[model samples]
Target: MTFEASLAETLRTFQALSSLRPAIDRAGDLVLATLARGGKLLICGNGGSAAEAQHFSTELVGRYQKNRRALPAIALNSDGSLLSCIGNDYGYDDVFARQIAGLARPGDLVVVLTSSGNSANILAALAEAKKLGLDTIAFLGRGGGKAKGLATCELIMPSESGAACQEAHLFLIHHLCERIDAAYAT
Candidate 1:
């Protein structure tokens, strides 16, 4: 697609997301509440979504736009050694699940991002997170695939285009960060 068309599509996706403001606000509330209750976040995704997960984690653990105490957040995809070992020993699908089993505590939040919403590792991680009594959230595309029913809360982008969905995910991440910062920054 041409640059103009791509930009237009992205804008259209943003417009579609505007209708989801209430859900988005609820998601922000959930994150803030979890943090206030001393619960950290464990996030996972694949490929581009993995990068997005890391980005969100950094924003929470570091800073979004305001100076504040660091919040606890971890991206499950950040550890190459753990991923390799898990993938080698238990198969690739077990990577995030294994980590969640070890690291997640009750009341922690697990956020999974997937454009297809059907990635095996993400689904496995969600299942593990659920079993461990962690609240689960998903940022998904393509009608949320099988992960929709699994999430305690979900934001499913309105478009099937991976690029569009990913773009929307970034926007949501930033909004979440902003809310967190506004609510907690000292």
Candidate 2:
């Protein structure tokens, strides 16, 4: 696609996010509430979404715009050794779920990102989180695929283009980072 076309599509996706305010705000609220109670955030994704997860966690654990105490946020996909071990022992679908089981405690939140919302691992992660009595948040696209309604709260990018969905996810990550930084400013 041409630059102008890409820009237009991204604009449309961002515009649609206004209608998603309630859900988006709830997601932000989840993050703030978990942090306020000294709970950590456990995030996971696949491929590009994995990178997005790391970026979001880094923003919270490091900084968004200004100085703030480091927050607890783990990107479950960041550990290659652990992931390969889980995948080898259990299956790729259990990679995130197993980590959630082992690392999560009460008051923790599980956040998963997927443009397609159909990955087996993402689905497993959400289910594991819910089964453990933890609230789950999903950033998804393409009508949330089969993962819709599974999360306690979902931010579904109303678009079919995965690229547009990913772009939207990045924007929301930054937006949430701003809220987190302000809420826990040092």
Put down candidate 2 lDDT per residue, 1-186, tens digits, no spaces.
999998888889999999999999999999999999999999999999999999999998899998999999999999999999999999999999999999999999999999999999999999999999999999999999999999999999988889999999999999999898788787
What's the TM for model 1?
0.97
Local accuracy by lDDT, each model: 0.92, 0.95
Cα TM-score per model:
0.97, 0.98
Candidate 1 yields a Cα-based lDDT of: 0.92
Candidate 1: the clashing residue pairs are: none
After superposition on all C-alphas, the RMSD of every candidate to the true structure, in Å, is 0.9, 0.8
**True lDDT of residue 100, candidate 2:** 96
lDDT of 1 by residue, 2-51 (tens): 99988888888889998878878888988998999999999999999999
Those runs of model 2 whose alpha carbons end farther than 4 Å from true positions after fitting are none
Count of clashing residue pairs in every prediction: 0, 0
